[model samples]
Target: MIAALIALCVFALSGFGLSFWLRQKQDSSQPGEAATRGAEQLSQLRWRDFAKLVLQAMQGRGYRPVIEDGMPADGIPTDGSDILLERGGERALLSCKYGTGSIVSAQSLLGLSKSASLRGAENVIVVTPGKFDDEAERIAVPQHIELIDGSELWPEVRPYVARPQEPTPVPPTAASNIPLMAWGGAAVAGILVWFIVQGLQPDSEATSPALAPPAITAAPPASVPPAAATPATTKPVAPPAATFPSDPAVIEQHRRETANAISTLFGVDRALWSTQSTLMVYLSSEQSDPVNELCPLLERYPELASSRVQLQPPQGSTKAVRFKQCRTY
Candidate 1:
């Protein structure tokens, strides 16, 4: 009885704590106005710093960000996107500017704003430290240049901010038709395969019985009972035995090799191996050694990108092998 009371109290306390914590987070969260002001301040950074800030905003909105600056024009080849964002087929271009004066002339915001429209920007937003003047505000509606000032910036950003959605509840059931159908198909295939492989798998159980030590009976005293008049000569006979690989490890290794060969032939193998089968593969994990190394080399020599890896068996019965025709993916 006491234990039940303690359990009820614990449940009640947990509910209360969860509700209180949720409400507290709601209360302490920054207001939209404050966020806009912070964004306005964020506009004043240089290109490198601007890239970081844009990435920060993009991450908040669940957009994947890529830093592309300080490279040759051909190297990066950006479409003049000051800040680029990609998310679920939505691409955004942000023109960030930090100036204290009112934005009166559209001509004033150059380098990014003008280049923005010409570059086919789907969405254009201009962030500034101060509010837009009447002329700037008047031009915004027509030009589709979203203005972000100290007052309205945060509210706009807040709406765009990404939040984790609650997961839908799922029931634990194993009787569903789809899974059952899949399992049924699998079972049928397994049975068929077992029938096929049984013949290929030697009858080791029978083999084991046959390989047991052979019986030996004392040879009847070498005597010729009735016809002892003449001496006879006979050749010795040897026991009949067949050599089979009964070692478990050797059987397993052979099985693995056969499976690997089958997978490679079907192009379903994921293991890193050269075609020769003699070359042991070594891979670089931290940084994709083989692929990453090729990209830069391709930049230097474009022809290398078109090459291919030649697949061939080893020349001799040698265990050591070599690979040729290394190229980009």
Candidate 2:
């Protein structure tokens, strides 16, 4: 009887201890809660400015690119440098890093690479606006990784994609003065920076915790690294057939815009163009010709034009975008 009682007592004590251990293990594994909290902190950072710079760089290199907010469990996605590239089966998975302290954390890179491996990704690329440290670079490349920094990113971001521009011949009246259309070209140039390769971060609270000393620019050391050729110069583009509907209301709105643009560029009050539906079919002077004419210019897959189309937001969006509505059309 005593043995039976003792056995029961021991079994009860063991069960309690085991339960306690299991609970402890679960508590330890709930590390995701901390990560979630951290992500919340970082969420305030838009990260877009940094992302834009990165995307433009990659696309400029003639590689198909996609942008996404996060990685997927299935590894099937198309967004943010978390991209999938297909170059004759030279497949790769990419994760982009944006404006942050100079240091590149090994934990972040290693985890990303491991994820890629799980997805059977042939390789990985990590692009950062900020620099990565030496240690991060050392660990990354032998593992079949590619690293791109801000300086390297610039030309790619500005890849001379064939785009349409209204080519205005130098009018005999004033050869030296920069054309108003050229100024329009500059506006489009701004779009290229923010458009092609850019990062958007959320507004995170400034914990103002002084960051550690910045990490040395983190990228694979170029030791007999294949030198990338410089991007070539290209001719300006003429407007391609823009994509939009011919909404009279939209067209008339653009007519007003054409007037404003002319005023800004040519210092003329004359609205030289008229719209049919949503399209702004217009007559342009030489000074503003490059921006106004469109039918496929020299740059590759251009998101902007020298003579451009402006698109407006729906009735209640925050701000108005010039020629944005036209792009959608």
- Alpha-carbon local distance difference test for all models: 0.45, 0.46
TM for every model, in the order presented, reads 0.29, 0.30
Q: Model 1 over residues 1-329: C-alpha lDDT tens digits? A: 44344444554555455556544554445454355545545455454444444445556767654345664332222343466555776655666554445453544442343344344445566765456775456435433467766455544344443441222322345223334444455455555555555556666675686676677988777666776756687888888643435676764453343223222221122223343222222321222123332223222323333333332323342333234344333
Task: Rate residue 66 of model 1 by lDDT.
Answer: 34
What tens-digit string does per-residue lDDT give for candidate 2 at 1-329?
44344444554555555556555654564444443333333333356544544445554555554333465543334343366654455656767775445455544565555456555567788865456776467546544578765444434543332331222433655432333334444444444444333333332453334744555888986566345555667999988865643565764554454343333222121333333323242222322332322222111122222334433233444553434132332
The Cα RMSD in angstroms, rounded to one decimal, for candidate 2 relative to the true structure is: 35.5
Question: TM-score of model 2 relative to the true fold?
Answer: 0.30
Q: What value does the lDDT take at residue 221 in candidate 1?
A: 79
